[model samples]
Target: MIRKIGVLSISLLCLAAITSCEKDFSEVGTNVVNNDKFETGEILLDVEITPKNIESVQADNINASISDYWLGVYNNPNAEKIEASIISQLGYISNLNNKDTDTTVFNLDKVILKIPYQATSTGTTDGVTRFKLDSILGNPDVATSIQVLENETYLNTLNPSDPSKRNTFFSDDEYLGDNVLSEGGIYQLKPKATDTTFIFDRVDRSSSLTGTTTYKDTIRAINSQKLKVPFLAIPLDITKMKTLFWDKFHSGEFLSKEAFDDYFRGIKIVATGSDGLLIPLNLASSPAPSVDFHYTISEVDGTTVKDTLQKKYSFPLAGVRNSHYKMTPATNSAPANNFVVQGTAGKMAKVKILGLDLSKSELTQQFKGDFNDNLNDYDIDDNGFLSLDELQKLFNYRKNILKSNSYLLMNDASLTFYINQAINNDSNIIPQQLFLYQNKENETGGISPTQLTDAYVDPTSFGGTLKKTDDNPEKYTFRITDYISKLLSGEENTTTDPLILKVYNPTDSPVNNNVLTTSVKSYNWNPRSVTLFNGNESANGTKRAVLKISYSKEK
Candidate 1:
């Protein structure tokens, strides 16, 4: 679906007389409605997201103040990078606008776009993130709805997290081996690699930029509950850092266990703000020089944004790594998904479950009207579990939707059930989701459950041998949409179909067999006894049935 991207928001606190110049990213209690004009005058440039590297591009269809612009991405296309100038060449800013608008007059190879991974498609999000990736990859002029984060945030200096000096989870811990060293906010490295491949490191015992005032920035988890602590995670692949951190200083020395532990526990990195964060200014490599504005809010006359924040980097001169680093404005869909899901799981169960992404399709609509309504619509609730009956019906309706198949036993710390209602039609209302699993207790944040024992079925509603053949193979995706939809709708039992299995194999002629009955997934909730579907007691030939999926780190 087409998503809105790249909406710039700035801080403009109107005090009595003097204009208050707010720091690069310090929020001084400003109203979003009152600052539209101010944001227009200011052009933000991210040096890290260069014209040569931008994978998603932006285009100006109609030039009007506050009028939404279109994003036009060109990967070797004729689209040009932003051309910034100090003073408006046409005597005013209008002249500069004229030149920028004219560049697309002749041969602007405009095409609809869809955002990929990076500003440059290399996979790393280290550069500028606020820019909309959808514009770079999707439709040329579709009104975007994104709030871009500022990259000009400045702070004092940075110093590495010394275990002895700090007290947070990332500080004061001894790391070991090639295994990802730090758990929550740390990593270990050895065997120095290229700066781009592994740039800043504590593994090789090196610091690129060193001075009294450090330039450090970070992505901190506010409320701590929102944290995806690296080490404690189930999927081991979350430890994405592979750049070796071998310290040649003692490369061949005894591989002493004691020293190894110390090296892991003692590495630190002191990065600075303002410098390391590269942003593009008005499409030009250069940015206007920054001045000390000391922007302040003497008073606020309107609504007090409640249950909320005023968090920032350490007081103009201190370090704020955990929850106070500068952040790029966003909520971009694709990149956000990249951070939450890995390719393996997505390829397995997500992207294909819905003949079209019900949520995304509503926004983009390109894949609409191409599905078999007979196929139970699939969905994955926020909790991540599929509906048993709906899933079975989907396969029956589109029985040939599999290239290969396998039953998953996900190892989870917790299981939950809930109900929700559809937003639009009273007749169209469906349950939100039926099942949810947590891989880790800590990662579960703190959800409260109403009941520990709930009865439900999980075997195939329409089943046979769930094995794949060489020819009748088609790729399939697994999604929990059915479960989520059921949970949200609060329509109990009505959505669940009894578990049953049947087989008709070609052996000279068609031979019928009642292979399995009772949903296997339902048995999983028991948390105790093992369920066996295909046994000698059954009158049919042996055919296996899977009860429930386990929740564990995918290998």
Candidate 2:
């Protein structure tokens, strides 16, 4: 039946049909008004990362003022032989009580070299004895010994700025003095605690009948305990050192500091014998690391000695130390999913992020953009401005405007590192903490001399110690949310530098750049853990380093 419909009824039918339409109107019609309110949603972006080899770095080029520098020797079974030595300048020693050690008055007793161990208290019963060593790598079961020799090398005499003269000293150089102060094998090395005693008063507070506390008889008890410290006490020969001191004293030549250093060159500490023990010693202790000279000027009344004058002289000194490492390529029995991470002066593990092409088309495939690849199609620019045409690209699968004039916010971003436990399972050799840095590779493919990042994430919030999980025992995670945000926020550029990893040194660093230019680096050595790469099929399939990022867009 043909029925006549009113104009209002036809308009109502057209409105209903347009509301039910599911096709995207923005593509077909240019004047379509998108009044849909913006909504918020989250997304996860995946980044592929791979590990690469890093070059060896000079250990001596570091800040010298701080005591964070290392001094020791360790021979790695699969890698290089590590050795270190210190050179110091002696301070002026005036005659004590107007008495000089010349032709008549003073008599020498003995000279002792005291080297303190790197130790810390764990709030345990033994206190200092229960303290743990900071950087005691390798097995401690084997026997090891240290030797002390007079260093005849004159460092200040050479030009200070010349790298070859001031910084190029090595382990094989013949820069030692003829006289050996303390021979090796003097102290047998072990990782056991020493006995210590403490006294404390016992206080008893109990409730009385009136609900008040009452004091009982107080008693002092002595608590004897032991702590583990890596200390070395080397006694120097009095006959040899005494002769050297007398020569300048009798000639009335208390010479200048430079002449004094040249006359009695600093001591060189050499470690040998056991391959297991190469521990770092603290050279910046409170008493100021030194050599103590014990003497007695005795006055005899009869055949028996009546007045025995006991006196001790200390030579306080401070100087730079040098580390020598003979690193051999790591020896792997079977191929694994990990690569090595080592550092010292400037050593690092270089890594490359894979499967990411920054081209617009590739970004579109991953991001699924609706616009064209050119500037006319894309909405965002280097200045972070977005056009209305760009806002249309954020439509959801339901063809709803999910985003408006808004910006993307990073919720979480992290880099996960998997350790090859099969190859590196030694507990002693594990790196305690790891650090992330910019690659800063120069034109010659080498890292710059001073390449530390000016910007750093909060240590408590980001990259730190490795985490142990039942599923992935050797996993290390780094929080890169702030770092990635900087890149997206136009604070940093990816084209300028890549990423690298190093061992984290816990010591407080000196802020002065001049000190870093001259001192030697002791800590931050090879951590032996390698990063797993993509496309490399292992027993457990392809294990790759991954950057997992979570972001949200506000409507």
Candidate 3:
């Protein structure tokens, strides 16, 4: 009886060990799901794919009223002149009170145009930032002439049909003082360090230097104020413009701001040199851009005593001006079909997906190609729709597999974008970051500018890292798991508005807080971004943009 009991206990122990081993294997098998398969089961891993094409559009009058003060832009190295101009609107003129005294000689005093530079440079003893408009690939001390000409063009207030005429003033507008302000009379705007002790290269490449040979030290600040000095002090030849000013002022036109605007218009500064400088001024400050008129007034005091007294007048710059840019497309960008996006907010390259369709037949065909799995279990009809009954089969299969043995869930989902580097090899010109937003149109049927909250996904957090395979750089994949989930769960409000990928600049602001609601487009304060061709297109590349998904099943 004792031998029989011990044998029975041993048999029970063996059976229990076998059962435990089977359970462990079953759990392991449940955790393992085919990466490239849409197997029949209670939990199915499926993906919705959409291919898109890109379109390019130029925003109307984008450069009309910009924030930056454009010094000059040398589009073609071999070209004769730079395609940039600076115009200033005259504010209240204080010295215009004595318009009656015509005989009073208004001597040609020094006319200085004060422009404060933006803090594009940093790293000094005081740790303040400054910037200088210097050459990148030319002589630093090379003498450059800035011709101060009076703007005779009229700024129309009426709305026009043509976009080019929207600004009212054209680049080729009649600039007064062409002959009056001779080249010899114009002073050379030579760049110099405010601090004599600090030493650095005045002219150098931008921060986007790709190679080691080009980078240079940034300009240093002095006394916590390196850029405190006003940028350009080009003394205008008051002798030549004296007659124009005299005629306008004595005619009682300077009495009213509107009359002065029509009579004097504004001043235009044209830069002439081989090298160009990107000098943007802080127009939103004191000592603002202005013209000082110095004159002598003769007064007979009491008893025929003629006294010559020196009096001064000031004309502040009215806050209306813009920096114009003329860009010549490269050989690659010359193609008609090629999409292009550039500048801050000047232009935009668009990525548009056709309709979002995940029909039963469409799903089956797309899945068959993507999964590459022999779905022998699914009795799918070749011509008919993949009906609910067929889909239930897959679910039922998954359920049976997970019956008291395994578990599964989705792991990740993403959308990938591949950049065509070959399109633009110039590393310095490439955009630092890209933005995605819902491109909505306003009441005017124009693509409205995006606000800060409109950004859907950014590369810093959701964008893919640069991946290179062999010698070729691959695509940038962004995790759109939540976005895709919303679409699949029928929770996304994406029917009316589609997604658009644009070059994003975080520091973008309105030209003026007061005129923000006006028709004028905001300045492109952000960094430039690149134009990405559709990956699905054969002409650009074979790498197609895809919504990738991965999940597991319990069975």
Candidate 4:
């Protein structure tokens, strides 16, 4: 009886397998499988941000070598009314010749101070080329009053208190007193035609074949072309030039460069107007900014002219070029809970990360608050309580986690700032990028802004470029993985300094020796403004600024 029962069971099993193969397979158990068992998730946290009005920035040592000096007055509706000026010292004339030892009489024809405009040729029309000034901020049609004043203050290259460091000058320095040398009158951003046409010498090369004899003929011709290059031609006072420079031609003051610098300090170019534009003047360009002394020298022997010659002595504007800025804060024009960001001694925003310094108990409470419903799912010990030690073991993973037994890792940490579209709708005036830095206390108990360590590690990944949707700038995103990781891992100070958000200045150094650094000297020449939503929950709601961090943790 037992053998018969075993054979019957084997036959039934074979029949069942054969019947199932004949029919179509069914997905009845597919829904029972857990697809999200090992999936990772992210946590979004809100960050606090506030507006900070900048009074001034270090503007000394901002010469032609590092960056172009700005000059003019501009009224920004969002931030401040800025008036930019330049104070520059003239370089000395090397190798002075004693030609005036004889009876040589010097007669000043005219003294002119020329500052070439940064212009580009648009097109040639009717034998004349049209040009437009480059890097002109605000309305170019408005006229401004320009004045060149004698700077009585001596500009030192090194700090008087500490010779090791370079001298620092703020934007609000009063370098020009009542010493007006040349009042340049009302001036607009228009190209000025030359008073006289320039004569150009051209050579034409032509080849002619006649009776198997080749003849190459070269003809030299003179062509007249009226050249027009945009520049500021301020007619300086000839009498003043004679007294300041010409009279001391062969005197002891001209014997040394330092002596001449002490005698004639420098010139300050100031701009004043109700409505005007700001322009960047390139003092290092060809035919740089200079005071040209055009004169004629006649060798007079008892009123009998022996020899006569026309000459020009150009005193180039060089050495210790500083920018002075006077800013009047704008009225409260931005929307409620909106902050402003501007360049060139403007304003910035201060940022603080929430819950960045929580204790173990506080962190456990926050974790519970963030994942109250899923706390039981993550509690692997099968206990009703979830401890901080277990959560750390589960989520605290190093950047290189292959060597450790950690079960979770942070992938990215970023801050997204939404633009206030009502105030910052104009794309032309919006800043192309933004920068995030931290202010470190200096030796003198002063704070200085410096770049984050992530920027130095990889600038491409540490993004601050403007993000747009449908070709319209909508927001700016910054990747701060290293910085956030350090804070989480207790590598950095728990009481972290507030990060500063400002308009990106291209001249600021992004990296040095594989470490991030920033320029303490003033180099932000851009005059643009942008308004962003401050992280005020009562005002902005969901659109308020927040720190979004994506991570991968065990389920």
Candidate 5:
């Protein structure tokens, strides 16, 4: 009898060899796993303390040690949106008093649902917590009731399919069936009138770098064929664009598109991804040329300064290089087309431009030369050509600077989505919205971004300390690479999550190297993560450019 009792002990029960009738998975059937196999994940909303209610846990110890409950993400179509808003609002939720009641908190235009999911060491998890999705106004407010559970079910099946295995990015779109497929998913987007358009909220890669156009009436043949333009966001309005600065001609409202023909014309407003890739912005019809504006760089310095040689990886190369060139950050308010100097004598330059047609003669002449003080005053005439007086000034600049035709056309310029995969990586590689977002004030909730000045480790943040359970990371590694590269190439007819990272080299000036970067970094992930939002990762290797990814499902 004593031996039989010992066999049934809670600790020894699983190993007891008594019943042949028991299922092989009985061990896992009894507990929620803390690994990457499940799609559903969970987060502990109240990290303060265990309630006087749950007796088994060190409620007081756990609660007392937590500054605020750190959140994990899963099953969210918009983590970037949520993360930014959380950072700004400092989403601090607490049931300090453990009230059963609720109240409205903050209202915002960009608050998405607060799903219950997060990745942990053992597996993705959730605390038996629930909160209302949102208020009638779309923004969430109020502290609501929560049910913190030590155990919850995680049932998410992840299909680590290959991109090369499929015919196109869309074969699995409608077939994905509740899996929450994203850009890096097996499925591609299909064209539809309802497809959302994106606006270039910001493009750090966008430059005032333009070569003179050699316009010919022959080139004026309009592209009558309708195009599907996608933007990073949605319908662009003058209100949102007004925030960016473009060089003013000291002119009027100029609302009438008809009056803007002479020097700048035949340009259309199309949607682009946050990185400035042309996305399907207007589905109803293709975009048409409207108006042209001046272009300018912000910083005036002639060169990029290196902060510290050894710290290249410690700080983003984008910041270092851009800071080196004393150029300004170009904005929607800047002139639509303009030429800016990149390098001084004996030095190379990094100049960028957008919105000018290199096919136009007026531009070609201006760009064909080394544009400088002498290049200025190139008079513009109707029908688009230099006033001839300006041609003389350009004659000198073009001679010295433009030796190798000194001009290259960015005809291939268009919006594209980009992706980089790692054996281990974080979802923060997804482009987050910096313009509009907010946090929830309540403790009990759905998806709310959790802020951290010293944020917890993510796939990108993870050093070599974590284990290598990179099963899922390996699966998505290849797909994510193709997924992002395709987006950067502007491939259409595929479904993508709203989240994307707007990347660019911080150099407002020109770079000696072609790799452009941005401060924003994030990624799209495997659907199985029910609770993990983004991974705690940090890129590694002797070359800072070498990317590395890692994760911690638990302590």
Candidate 6:
């Protein structure tokens, strides 16, 4: 009886182990098997990469999509000369009480264009405060003439041809040949002693008891605080502005927003000379860039002055702020050492897989070269040619690779791009990240760039961030396991379209929990560049771009 009980216990233990190892292979369209019957390995594939220079990009400033507008010229020794200028439409101030009987006169004071610098205070000293400007790309001390001009072109909101679509503007669009508005002079990043002080009120509130159960009105104390802020106070031509803007206010041109826009189209701020002072301007900041119309209204009692009050009407530099880039192509047509990648209508690279579109027969022939031993399970007849039954089995096997079935499973697939340190050694100027998108052809025969399927599935996993190490090469690696699996399984058709690699923009991903339906419509304002190996090097070159894939297959 004791021997029989021990035998029964052993039988039940073996049955439990077998049941736990059973797998529902129907999920992956494969045969049922145990989990420990597969072998894991990795392979490296070749890819073709080519560099393409971008002449211009769609840089429309509609709805203030682009936050940062560049101003100044950047001259790089290895790359092109980039000239950036700002053309913006001014916002109108409505509801001005011109009919007030208390104010009978309007006298124009000095008009100044205030453009605030992106700076942070470096602590106070005695009674004065000092600040350092942020992201001054080139030499900040270099002098350059900044010209403010009246924009002659009327920036339309809607497209005239289609009406349903918004008007699109390019970085290379022309907005010159207008009357100069600024008091032309050489400008530098010199913080003035007089304009450094700013005054603001600091209010304190407290409660006082009036009765046993009720409290009196809150007691308040107001104190004025003075601090220093850095900004560019470019004086405009007072005479021209009075005739053009101030006089028009009384002439009923400022009655409506449309009337004002038609009369005064916009203003253009352009930097002259190749002094290499690229100022990053954020017009959307608080106390935005504007043309201040400082004036005074005098209250008179029958031609006798009663009281005088200083007033100001500010026309903000808002609505349709466009950045026009004038880029001069690099002199060297070919950089034999490395390929260049830049932002803001700059250079990019086109990437393509070498054998992504091979037919079943071709793929079988290629598989015979390296994975011939693994094909033994499918080719049951031991024939060189794959029959219909064998082809169906091969398709199922590849499909199961993505599902991690017992038959086969794809673990990872990635592409690593090594940086050319010989050229792009400056970490400050090197782009922090790179973006890759598919250049798909639309029905209108135009190429539209879109994010890859891998990005949509999981952007975190589809990495393109710059990876650095103490001993290894600085590189950008992208994992595209799903993309490769679809291609290998014939689930997705391989097209002639190639992947475009460009500088990363925040708009490349969805914002504010919005659905990512389209590619980036705004211009890439990041003015940085990097040089990378094209992967067409010799057979033994380690820096050559290649797709590395790791997978598990039936042994």
Best by TM-score: 6
TM-scores of all candidate predictions against the true structure: 0.16, 0.64, 0.54, 0.74, 0.15, 0.76
Candidate 1 lDDT over 316-342, as tens digits, reads 101121111112212222211111111
Which candidate number would show the highest lDDT if scored against the true structure? 6
lDDT of 1 at 216: 29
Error of 6 at 29 (Å): 17
Worst 10-residue lDDT window, candidate 2: 1-10
User: Residue 14, candidate 2: how far off, in angstroms?
Assistant: 41
Those runs of model 5 whose alpha carbons end farther than 4 Å from true positions after fitting are 1-116, 119-138, 141-172, 176-379, 382-555
Worst 10 residues of 1 by lDDT: 522-531
- Name the candidate, 4 or 5, with the larger TM-score value: 4
Alpha-carbon local distance difference test for all models: 0.19, 0.46, 0.43, 0.64, 0.19, 0.65
lDDT of each residue in 301-361, candidate 6, tens digit only: 5555555565677889977778888877765543664677888888889987654333445
> Model 4: per-residue lDDT, tens digit, 379-488?
44322332333333333321222222223434567888988877777666688888888876767988876778777776887787888777777888888877766555
Show model 1 residue runs off by greater than 4 Å: 1-255, 263-266, 275-445, 448-481, 488-555
Worst 10 residues of 6 by lDDT: 1-10
Residue-wise C-alpha lDDT for candidate 2, range 208-251, written one tens digit per residue: 11223323321111222222333445667667777666445544
Error of 3 at 32 (Å): 18
- Please give, for residues 215-270, the per-residue lDDT of candidate 5 as tens digits: 22111101233222221111222222222111122233222223222212111111
